[model samples]
Target: MTRLPASLLPEGLTAAVEEASGARVVAVRPRGGGGASRDGAELDLAWPDGRTASAYMNYDVHRAGAGDDASFLREAAVLRALSGPLALAGVRVAPYYASVPDQRALVCGLVAGCDRFGAITDPVQRDALAADFMAQLAALHRIDIAKQPIEGMGPIESADVFARRRIAGLRAGNSGRAWDPLIHLALDWLEANIPADMPPPAIVHGDAGPGNFLFEGDRVTALLDWELVHYGDPMADLAMLCLRMLFQGFVPLPQAFAAYEAAGGHSVDRARLRFWRLLFQTAFARRSRYDDPDAPPPPNLGMNLVYSTIHRRVLSQALAEAAGVALPPVAMPDAAPGAHDRSFAVALDDIRDTIVPRLSDQQAAVKAKGLARLIKWWRAIERYQPGFHAAERLEISAALRRDFPDHGAAWSAFCQAVSDGGIETEAAIILCNAHAAREAALLADSMGGLAETRLAPLD
Candidate 1:
């Protein structure tokens, strides 16, 4: 929804588009849903003989230093490599046009479809579309990594190594900063249980899920968002797909799994899938923190908070499953009135009842709703956060057998205690469950009767 001003376009972009399309650039408009990591636009170009064409442009503006550049180039290379194979398989991937690494921009041919796949009403048609998506994923996994030799993708000895590398990178990313205890615990679990035997690595779409793809009716028009493409176990993509569906409510998980296997995906590995699910949810929860200086700012603070709350809850569920812990039901905290509580509530009502309805831009309206939810959350935080933190800190201190000034310090101490065998797994699981439950309760309080997905306890 955030449109790029005409003045913000780089001077050479027009020339680049002209050279690629053999036409003069006529106009450009920013596209919606560029996501937190990139900016996107559609360019209108005119040929010399009065013909015209359109192309998509993406700028990798969320550069987290060199790793980002490597990621961009790797995606570009993957797109280039997979173009022929994907087209042959009737999978619609946007054709690669040109990439300017210096400008951190890439242009590709526009594909026809929208990202709202869940809008399709016919259950049969939706199932067929889901099957087609699985078919495309199966085809992608069938790609011979050795024969392709994509630039920027290095070989790993095994999927286990690849998983470990990712964990290490996350740790490195969080170095010298206060760490989240839940993330540390998840990492420990993942490290302890890397699937010993696994299928050979295949090209994995690291971010494969509903929102990343486009569809028209029951058919998937294009599988978009290749920023996380890499060579890895295909289960990574499958796990990501199911995790996304779990949150989106687009398809039944068991049915989707059957379709995927029928379409030639590897046999279902429930344990490994669960492991990857925990990793995916934890990674996203950490991202919701928005603490990385190198990452781009979220579209708005409200959207970020909403994302954080939802993912944190999901992460909690995943952690509980992995740790074999039963989380107690989150009890609502007693609300204490603050001086600004009434004002915040009034502002939230105005945004929901007045401002959002009046907004002409659909995307702006959506953002307004998110802002309203954020204001409600702020009210809850004001009332409950201090008391909740105090209680949780006391619990963590008791578990660790040491006191700390805050949660972060206590978590660090607890992680060390676990590493040194001072704290047992069962004890850690209890503390983690309590911590997660309290956080989820705070988030639920913030919703103020708004409907949100409630994650079920692990079986």
Candidate 2:
């Protein structure tokens, strides 16, 4: 029997499970080492019939007192509703339940165990695994929201609303900071430029990634974690999956993209995916800036760079898609930026004197000052503009939008030069100091795992 601190287990959770399943609870053990393990215990149940059961016990952090119990019950209701339907497809989920009236705790049954990413190397295993994942994704999307029983969770009906809400959250985080003007501009454009009508709403697994899944030899045995699940566009799930996979540097793009397309995924609007990709990049960049320095590198780093690189590639691809004209690959560095220099200083100087000075006085003065200083030293150009080689990465990205028609062709052409160089570079170095890093990256074999793909960083 595995013993635990009484406070962590709460009161009667053990008895509740025993009563619900009619299993004799002989021992409770803790399971760890997975991506979704929270600050709680994993219970292992031993019965007289020589069988065993396991459950996940997690502490709720968003509510108070009995409110936590209510939250778990709500999730449980969703699980119950999805259970029968999912079982038909060879899928099952641990029953999500809450023990006691405390608003800060939850206890859920843990389903059959399986291997993690240890088995993703084999192709047959990979395809079967991808198929199973898609089936679960389809199952989630097929849920009838109207009949579901979660209360506080709102209906996600419109892509416009989703975009707006996301933008709003980003703006709120910006506050009166110096980056507001550029941030605000992007947010406004996204809000006004939403697709005419997105594919109808479906329940989405917001954080669909390899890390959150348990695979038994390429077969996804379980899709773990549901905190971010909600009713929304099916594309949202696809985007999340792509973003997660690409960020982790798992494999080739053609393979990943094709796998997704083969899995009954038909919605592939370039503009729609591009929008989410850009939004995901911008949001993640800001988040990285605010995260704890000691924490693991943000998953968004590679993605941010990929978006910027693609922005440039898109210009060429757009032309190719429309005219069958294959443009030269730009010589863009697949690396981060470098330290302060004349070009960077010049860009910052422009933002401070030209851009910041023209902003509305309604903004906070202190934020303006800080932003001015930050802008002066903003050697972060990978996400903003990734098409330029290290030699001029900062200048091109900073000027790409601002300079517009004047530098458009020249900028794009420059990116083509870099893209053709065929090299891998560090994301941070490319943004901070691309000029020096470009040559080295071109000679290097891997550029942030982008390979021969025309990749870039997102905004």
Candidate 3:
């Protein structure tokens, strides 16, 4: 535990934590963020008199490729503030301890609770927790952000202006990289559809939803993940809750909204909520995160592919819903077995049977599981990518009324058309949804629970 192995943390962090805590660091264990961008660790410290205490440190030290460190510092500031007068109403955040700004680490007293809200088997138990969490969101939104000006966070503005600034930054960040046409289209559409309403802005848990908060038994313990916290329309948080429910199941939205309204939160604004829902979904699907230094790269790149497929599909569906279009259902492809099927099967067997059992290191076992997901995806690619590619090419050519010699060329042209307004939004969306659906089917087996995601109705 005294060692600063590369797997655990970068060098100097150990020293920084020790200095900040005024204690000897007896141990530190890696604690992965379930779906959030941050990485965390459990640090056990000892004082001079044989007294020891445990603290949790949330950090991201593996971002060696990117240049920014602003987000982590900002989160530390939020955590510090929330522990004081600027805190959310009736909600509990982790107790603030110390922050090592140099290494982007925040140390805090550890609390015990499960972040997995959907895994609870009893529907009544899950409903009770969901309602309590909903009330927590209401309490959070009731905190007038203007009175609690957080340092380094962006200016509080109307929902339209906030969306404008946020979407503009994402568009600028993703401009040249342009890997996903759907993102290009969705961002553009979101830009064009910014809501005109300006309700009282509140300190919203920007990524508020299922899995973002924690509960123990039937009691909500703490709302987790303040990394995406910001001052915006409270309705935006409701929107985000709906989106997160697509992947991480939650109590019904009507039930959730009733809880929110009854708890003294702002009334649910369905229009603004839908707008922010699309905004958040497109934001999550962005290619710009790949370049972000704060974003911890997935242990397996295959998992990234798996996530991107889900995001793209859901994004297209969300966008189409906003545009009042029902996309044609995509046909499922018969995944004909390819030559590498046996190899992929063998690798999965080895990972499950041999490699994983021998991996005494928990981190290594997690990585092995991730690698298995990628191999399964590769197996699907071998079986179906050729047909998917050809189908996309035809769809693009038909949409644009022109032909391209290569799939890459067609993709580039389609995205360009989306950006330039040369093609009908309906046509563009249909094609984008089709492409996303095909990729979803390709990724379904590998994605496990994430494959069958359905957007909850924003009633």
Candidate 4:
């Protein structure tokens, strides 16, 4: 193995070419980020017969440690075993000696393929992309996992554990104050109704969706990004795919399901599909509340998924009552974006600038808790971070009270005082506290919020 320049590789990875193959590295390139992104690189290598070709490399940030090399080798082995039979396959990654000192980053070959997101706007392209995705999924599902134990993967067979883990991820990041009561109630409801049993699990690309693949015209040139691969019920993948579709607002629900089924996917029981769909959607709703940039553009150009989820619940209940069915507790709140993106943006900026700086001195352990992190963030907002203009914060707080009337009598009384045109200085101070309180509450309250009363329901 020849030593490559440290400057040639990313800050964390070690690079070398195989001497036996007469492969000599010649060049490198860089790429961008998306849903399941690994940074990209292009390697021009000279072969033994005086011929040269380029092999693309992708370095995933998640697999940055030495221990992960075996797991990655296993993933590459899975692809290598299956690539030959699939209708199309990106060149399966080749294992190379890793010199990565950090255990949180990775580097691998890049595949030159087109993105599907760019194609969704075009009709012919969308169909072709869907066909490619379905074909790839079917091929992946058909693989025989009974042979060697695929390392670093496990069976997520327990319904109780699955639900608990999902709920924990949500709660783990929450500040346990005003929002805790409602979030806990929702969790309790979900726990009581944990489906009795799930179907047999299969090898699933734990996080599968359109954005994770690459398209060459209508055909999938490569199935990119496999970090979350695991063994799970096939319906989990199916439900998540449909959820992505809905979030994209591409078509009617039944039509999307019909299209998927037509693309060679076995149609699971509709009820089961709906169960997984709602479960995945709720997880998404909670995760999106944290302001992730990559989440499918808010279903209707809207930012507040908490408001959206709650509004959906209200409608679901209203419809159930109309149909003479037992209406479950429509306790789901309106999960809408804050009345002004500006406020959230302002708050977030304060977190980045003022809050993070002061807390730079805090131990990383305290920084890990969501509430502690948020409180540290709020202290920054009140002092140096101008989360909301003084007058604006007051107005927003008053508005939040009306929008989330279920925030109980305490909040109602507080908002009532502000709504009555109180002093700007007093109102601003109160609103700042309320703003922090509400954010803390939302994290606790199942990570959602109410829709502003002024806006009509989205169609």
Candidate 5:
């Protein structure tokens, strides 16, 4: 076992973890898939009674903690609320050990497994794991939220009230930002399409999807990532699972739904599921003002861009499906070589060819790849975006019945029209889809498998 100085963590944090674990920390291995807001690690421990154990730690670097009844506090609180009930229901969840709000950290018993369902290689084994995961999800959804009250999530309400609250919450988050017209249209559609009725709300794992659950062999070890937990439609989880399947492969939706229903979960409500899918995607895909040339990128710049591209494209597609419109094929621009093209190519080669291989640390290598993606995007914008902008501007100008001196001006006007409902629904949907498709093409090479992923048919 290894122990280090107290300074490695915030004051009193190390002691808090050790006291909760009743063991000494030996090894701290960085857990992957952290974003700018959060990070964590797996800690190998040695107990005095000749027992060995491991625990996972989550560090909220953004410290979305502290405020009374803060929404972010639910991340750790929900685990505490559900762990017992879920275990009693034959579902496995990580055991909560401690919450250190002062340090924005949480410790829980580590469940050994990997989150990448795509890596299971064997078809039979992968299917088994996904089925098992569905069982766990079903069991979770079956838990009676009414009977097992979770505090700090606000009082339970009817589905319509819940829907309105969700809309309000999203508006609050979008406040004080440069509005993206697609977001405005998406929000309107979401507000209009709230189901007349919904099943009884349960504790929905709001971000449930591939890469958020762990599995080993034929068993799902535990579901991970509870940052977005809330009491709402459990179908939200299924919908998000579909989204994750597009990014990280899971079993086909038909098979997955079968497993869930078989496990005593409610039958799949396709319309409701799609509504939540649209909600989840649109809520996350809103544009931020980070494209300014002088603005500095956070360390994980690639994650930001790739996630944005995926969400934007998915949101566009979801709108089309919901609106009963078809997206006409979008045009691709021919590459226009620039003075910086060779320099861009040289840097990309150095990253994929030279830098990533020499990095032994898995987490570091992941960061290096992300850096490479940032460069690829820059390269793309230089070589192809001019043509893309030109074509897109022409399309928008015709739709708006006005001509702008520049693409930037045309786009700004188009966005204003869409946001103001000056454009018809079909035209807006097609325009948004066309724009998303072009953006997707630019990021396709960097996104790889995820670029071609489509929503599973809801049959």
Candidate 6:
């Protein structure tokens, strides 16, 4: 668990706990690796009558804008609506206590007996756990969105609208940047082949996957991370599940789909599921901007870069699948000569030997180690990136058969051409795959283990 500095804790947290539970907060510890959008902490409180209780606090630091509280409220509302139904189905969700809208913070009862499901070692137990999770997901999808309405779920007209809105949102977020041809090609394909028939919008857990839930033994104690909840096609959640399996080794896709259908969810629509999987992967690839000047710096820059690389690779694969083409093999770049700068090596040694041991907070120490690893990666790739990029740009220019001011301009023109139907689908697929492969190779050289594992394409 990560520990937060006293100054980082919200000022009103203690007072809020006192008011809500009539208890005084005795301790507050930050939970490491909080979700993508929020910071979490466990608050230990002592009641006035002498009893003790624990509450979990989640503060929206990234998703909340300057004066808008809508994001926080939206999640709170979803939790409120599904609390009873989920509890009844033996799918536990944290009870909503109170919201500090001003700070964009929410307080809920701290759930116990739940941890990451990946820790299970026994094969039989792991399979049972996977089934249990599928059953819980089915129950969630079976929720009557009309009867138990959640405020601020936004418009839920159809799956196409939802998919388009998401694509539009991603485009809007990155407007004025160099266009990504793969995204455009994928979008064009999606628009041309929108599924005509889809199940009515169900309550979709926008990010349902392995790490998002909590479990103990073979049973899931609680489903966590409801921040992205919204109403959309149920397959959206299923796509996310498959995506999770693609990145993280979890249950097989066929088994998971079987379990879900057997537990009362809609039958798997292969075409729609494929479309959604591509869309989700595209959205992730497009939206990940580690160097965004407008946003705050990420807490862990190395991990951010790691995820960006993974998303880019996945996005390329998804696009190729959509285009019904196979990605060309990625050639490994020649290794760079030994590093002459001893400073990097010295710093890494200091971090591992001197700094990490001194740090009391395990999370901070882990982050420090991550920084060291990033430095090591820099040592490995610093000498090669310039040459690699030049070669890549030359290759891209050759593929496009045109000269442009720079790589960005060339890419934008290529994507625009593809979107305009000037480029053949197969040609676009090959070019995009080459681009994504080169980028992934650079990242893999910098950070190990990213390019080594190849998951079989989802059937």
Best by TM-score: 3
Query: Would you list the clashing residue pairs of candidate 1?
Result: none
| TM-score attained by model 3 | 0.90
Can you write out model 3's per-residue Cα lDDT over 225-289, one digit (the tens) per residue? 66667778899888878877877888778989998898788988898888888887786776535
Instruction: Please provide, for model 2 over 233-291, each residue's C-alpha lDDT reduced to its tens digit, 9 standing for 90 to 100.
Output: 76666666655554343344345455555655544565676666555544533422324
| Model 1 C-alpha lDDT per residue in residues 1-459, reported as the tens digit of each score | 234335546567656656755776666775543444555677666678987667787775445222366667777777776665445545568877677776567777788887776677788888998888888888788766666566555553467777888888766654445466567677888888888877888888878878878888777777887877767777888778866664454567677777888988788787777777777777776645355565565545555555555666677767777778876654445766777899998997899789977986544665677677677777777887777777777877877777889976776787677556678767776676666666656566554432356543222
Off by over 4 Å in 4: 1-5, 16-25, 34-40, 45-109, 117-125, 147-152, 155-164, 168-186, 246-253, 278-459
Error (Å) of candidate 3 at residue 131 is 1.8
Error in Å for residue 26 of model 5 = 5.1
Alpha-carbon runs more than 4 Å astray in model 3: 1-7, 34-36, 47-51, 64-68, 86-88, 151-155, 288-300
lDDT order of candidates, best first?
3, 5, 6, 1, 2, 4
Pick the lDDT winner. Answer: 3
Query: What is residue 291's positional error in candidate 6, in angstroms?
Result: 3.0
For candidate 1, the per-residue lDDT at 65 reads 21
lDDT of each: 0.69, 0.48, 0.76, 0.44, 0.75, 0.69
Tens digits of per-residue lDDT, candidate 5, 62-145, equal 442212234456767777766654457766778877776655577788888887888778999978887888888888888787
lDDT of 6 by residue, 102-199 (tens): 55667777776655555667889878888888888888888776665666555556666777777776565545553567777676677677788888
| Superposition TM-score, candidate 5 onto the true structure | 0.89
Q: What is the lDDT of residue 329 in candidate 3?
A: 74
The alpha-carbon deviation from the true structure for residue 230 of candidate 4, after best TM-score superposition, in angstroms, is 1.5
For each candidate, give its TM-score against the true structure: 0.84, 0.54, 0.90, 0.52, 0.89, 0.87
Per-residue accuracy of model 4 over 186-264 as CA lDDT, tens digit each:
3433555556666545566655665666666767666655554555556666665664543333333454455556756
* RMSD for each of the candidates: 3.9, 14.5, 3.0, 12.4, 3.3, 3.5
Give the TM-score comparing model 1 with the true structure, all chains together. Answer: 0.84
Q: Rank candidates, TM-score, best first.
A: 3, 5, 6, 1, 2, 4
- Residue 328's lDDT in candidate 2: 35
